[model samples]
Target: MPRYRKRKQATQRKNLIGSLLIFAVLGLVAFLAFFRYELQNKQLAYDTETLCPSNITSPKYVALVFDKSDAYNKIQQQFLRRFFDDFKANLLPGTRISIYVIDAHNNKEIAPDFVVCVPRTGDDANALYENPKLIRQRWHERFEQPLDLAINGFMQPAQADFSPIMEVFQTISLSAFPLGSETVPKQIILISDMLQHTPEWSHYRGQMDFSKLQKTLYYQRINTDLQQAEVNILYVRREGMEKLQNKRHAFFWSDFIQSIGGRVTLIEKIDG
Candidate 1:
């Protein structure tokens, strides 16, 4: 009887030890899971659609100014497609992209075709916690589709009697990148023939001159503060207009952009 009692007590001790070990392992796992959840929530605590904080304001701005004063040919269109693809790929998740069109007839009116902040995609999601497939689907339905539609509509041929590129710039600087706002990275993708034609001043009349433009009242009227925005000129080259769209013409525009507190990053000529 004594021996049997001793064996029973030993078995009970063993069971208690096993239970304690199991509880300890579970406690460790719970701690790790809670830590991971806290860290992820802090970093990715953003709205799914805007990919921005609760304020819904983006930290970066990208403005695309399309000059539809002249129609783009098939080859130029192809080039534009490739350029847009590259631009989309490099964009950060929360960047705001606004599309503006320089009207063909009405140089005074500058209207935005599309404006939206990029959403977080599948690639930006964590597979361990979030469903990437659902995020991607939502992004495509809400963000990508509308952007594609707006761009396609602008790609169609539209000819204008005048191209008021300077006025459009001034308006964009005032409306899009308003003064006193928090300084953020700003970029302008200008797709045009780099030709400035209006009732006041026309580049087609004679040789391109930067000094002559600075002396005019129109220059003062169009004086814009671009807020140190980076300008990428997608210069459209027209057939049989070499003299107007040559290297000197490009330099003239470059000087003008610099005077307005904008840095010219690229001046790529898009030709058929």
Candidate 2:
């Protein structure tokens, strides 16, 4: 009876040990799985071509058109710099920004000088899981620097006989925000003197008559579909053109933009 009791006691100890081992293994596996999931959640994934976040299904589109037909004064430059700073700050992650420069000499094809999507920055990072410094550094290198360089290069003054503001707007509409596609949110920031001068139509030709403008062949050629885009006109004041650039001029532009399916949200004048 004593030998049998000793064997039973030994068998009970082995079973206890086996159960503990199994529980420990399962706990370790659960811990590993949880750690891997946390790491994945903290990490950011971006597309190679668009630089947009992989998780983003719909991203906002911002198009900036800098009309460099005339030189900007010191005051105007300072305002523009500050405006750009704010613009950069307000941009959300995964938003695509395209910067286009319209020069004095009109090119047959208009393309964006800089195009990039805002990447995940330190603000979007988790401190416990990821290094914010590295993420911010990558954002600055990949997005901020190149954009600043492109903008600075285009900010230089250029003199031309004609400022094709209308043609450039049409081109931007067709290329950036095409018709029948309202899936993505669109915004256009136009920094210009608001002087529409082209061979077909010229704001310099006395007063702007919207009725007459509609009758011209130039008006007929406008197949621009802004697709309900939000237009922000940063009107740069031109020297000795007070008669041309007045309340009437502003109204004409607002009316024109509205006529083309665009909503003129802001028509702020950049005072020089």
Candidate 3:
């Protein structure tokens, strides 16, 4: 009887040891699995751009939005959203560019990505749209000039959010970028109703006073200088009532596409 009891006690100890080993292995696996999950999530964070061979090396594409209309100033956010939905992912293969959507009036970068919905904050759109030379200069210096200083100063104390623009600039700054291509494609997609009312024109055509605009030709004409860009005017289409107060941004963005150096397509969608 004593020998049998000793054997039973030994067997019980063995079983306990086995269970602990199994638990230890499971805990290790669970820890490894959780660690991998975190790593992948960090890897897939929102990237402003992805690389591909069809790169144009344009100075860099800046998604410019102008929320300057007092008439639609409160509702200007709609246009910015529509712009993002149309082109954010469907962008041409190999085409990578940095994006910036600004409250053109305030010069504050309101949206960083393909943001579709934003509340309106009425402010005049500034014209320092996307010229690298202008960006390099001190923004406050822009106000010191005798020009429409009132319309041109920065709304917030921050200088400028050129990080996206600068990243591309550094990437392409190497030996002639888009390596084989002799010409670099440069563009600034200005999204606005093309309205300015500063009472007079400054030498810089796109700058507006934001206060003096009349509803007629003042807002009708977009800055014509886009003709100078290597591949200018990746234009988006817009049309809707001002009082609607919601971003009626059209998802049907077919009109704004151009090859690295190809002629700008002037396609437009007719509302059915």
Candidate 4:
């Protein structure tokens, strides 16, 4: 009887130990699974924030201003291709993108030549469940497909025309893009030669007297506060410009842009 009792106690201890080991293994697996999910979710949140941070009320806005006067060079084409190709990845749901042309004569009356407002389809919530392929497909169908068509049609080569860049700038700054919700951010991407070719202050003719121009009708009439917006200039260099001339051009634009509400974040020159 004593031997039997000892054997029974030993078997109970072994069983208990085995049960504890099984539970420990299960717990570790559950912890690992939860950790992975949390990590992935954190990554998704960060990506979304970097692309377009917004709240329940406000949405992000981006404006692509193409200078119709600037010749569409090889470098410009390459840059535009890359920009548009990567555009979908950098946008959040409900972000608006407007495409406009900077021409002296045409598109002057109209503020933004083309406007596209992205809709929220709640696809972002499925980031964990959906594969990359399906997500890409959804992006194309919703935003990228239409944008591709618009950009292709707009980028066709045209004669170098007069650039009413100041007028375009004023229009964009004053009323074209309104201050939507205080939380929303604004962006303007200017693809141009950074040369002002208007009658009031023509960079092609001579040096611009910014102080004198500020007191004139053209400047006073369109005083806009674009401090809330970020301006990025993808500078297209014109042929036959000396080093000094290019510096002057940059100075005129950078100063004028700063004088107004626009913040010049980047002034990158595109080369072939």
Candidate 5:
């Protein structure tokens, strides 16, 4: 009877050891599962769009502003407000917008918010341009897309005619539709004052060799499609920028716009 009891005791010890080992394994698996879940959530939260961070240390937001309001000698200031709000909305959410407003005629610098952030408030330095570097860095993971347009000279007949507007754009896209560089432009927006006139269509700036510009545009265009990148032209004059201004902006901009996959909207008259 004592021998039988010893055998039963040994069996119970073995059973207890097996049960404890099984529980330990189960506990370890649960902890590992929970830890993995937490890590995945952390990574996911950082990799997507969110509200704009008031500070630039965060990695996903970018803000760009071209304040043409220096020319707003008259129109209601609220128009400028609408223009900015519309611009902010057009950007992907959680984007930070840095603003730069240049005096329409004198080239005087107007610091909307970057008053203390820059060395001197003028075109002499890109401090105005530098303020947005943090945000631009966030786009480095994507391909670089170059965008060029006549930001200053789309009005004169010779200068405005067939502006090598696509040169910069192609420079960034030849290898990939989107070029991935920490500071390269992933998109392009042209904000223009819509008053354009071709004084005399006789001689052309074609006398000017934009081979460099044309080359920059052509090669990238070979690899990229005008359809893929989002191009927005914010015209200070919505009066008929993409429609009526075509006679000067391009040979037939209405058609070019269709071919290129873009839409034009008036950015409120700043020159009135």
Candidate 6:
């Protein structure tokens, strides 16, 4: 009986030891998982650009200046929608987007009429969120809606007959962006026919002369500095204009804009 009791006691001790070992292994695994989670969070927090990067990146200011005189066709709609889709993806913390109209009466001023401004704010709290769906939802709710509304509003036909693109450019470069931050990226997206048809210079009447513009008071009046802003002119092709004329118009504007401080980056023809 004494020998049997001893064997039973030894068996009980081995069972207790095995249970302890299993618990220890489980605890170690839990600790390792927690550590990995914390490390990933830290990395994401450091790397994420929450509205403003921890590093030095200039604020981006985008102006979508549209010529109200141009026909708002389906092709223009598609291109603009595509642009907005890309814009949604690339939007960072310190980005501002504005829509303007190049109309006939600019209050007798050399400036485009302001339509709306969509500015992006940073979400520091959600920067390290594990789920990307929530992040996109936030962006769509805040930034995307306002931009879409502005575009829709601009798509409506205006009563203006003339398109003063030069004045619009000058206005945007001079007054649209904040005055103090010249180091930031200033982008002007022009949606027009690339044909300047103002009271001063009419492209249809063959009175479009760049040399005379320099000599006139209008040039001096609209000679506001762009501070090396980039211009992307998305020329909307009209129904009657020849292919050669369109090409010439694009080239003329490219050279004309570059003559000023603006760097004309794109001169694409949008067929409607």
The prediction achieving the highest TM-score against the true structure is 2
Q: Write the per-residue lDDT of candidate 4 for residues 238-268, one digit (tens) a residue.
A: 7785553466677777777777878888988
Each prediction's whole-model lDDT (CA): 0.80, 0.81, 0.32, 0.69, 0.36, 0.69
lDDT of 3 at 262: 25
Better-scoring candidate (TM-score), 4 or 5: 4
In order, how many clashes per candidate?
0, 0, 9, 2, 12, 1
- Tell me which residue pairs clash in candidate 4: 226-261, 227-261
RMSD of 6: 7.6
TM-score of each: 0.81, 0.83, 0.27, 0.69, 0.35, 0.69
| Model 1: residues with Cα > 4 Å off, grouped in runs | 1-57, 105-111, 178-182
Q: Can you write out model 6's per-residue Cα lDDT over 140-230, one digit (the tens) per residue?
A: 6755675677677787778667877787777777656666768888888888776777777777877555676678887787677777889
Off by over 4 Å in 3: 1-13, 16-22, 29-33, 36-62, 65-266, 269-272
In candidate 3, the residue pairs with backbone N, CA or C atoms under 3 Å apart (3 or more residues apart, or in different chains) clash, namely 58-185, 69-73, 78-247, 104-125, 104-126, 105-124, 105-125, 197-212, 197-213
Worst 10 residues of 1 by lDDT: 47-56
TM-score, candidate number 6 = 0.69
Q: What are the RMSD figures for all models against the true structure?
A: 4.0, 3.6, 17.2, 6.8, 13.6, 7.6
Arranged by lDDT with the best first, the candidates are 2, 1, 4, 6, 5, 3
In model 3, state the lDDT of residue 97. Answer: 45
The sequence of per-residue lDDT tens digits that candidate 5 reaches over residues 79-182 is 54455455433544333323232223222332222211111112222342243454444332221111012112222122223223333233323322222333
Whole-model lDDT, model 3: 0.32
Candidate 4 lands at a TM-score of 0.69
As for candidate 1, its clashing pairs are none
Candidates 4 and 5 compared by lDDT, better number: 4
Stretches of candidate 6 off by over 4 Å are: 1-58, 108-135
Reference-based lDDT, residue 86, model 6: 78
Instruction: For candidate 1, write residues 184-270 as lDDT tens digits.
Output: 899999988878888888889864788898998988989989888999999898888887888888889889999988899999988
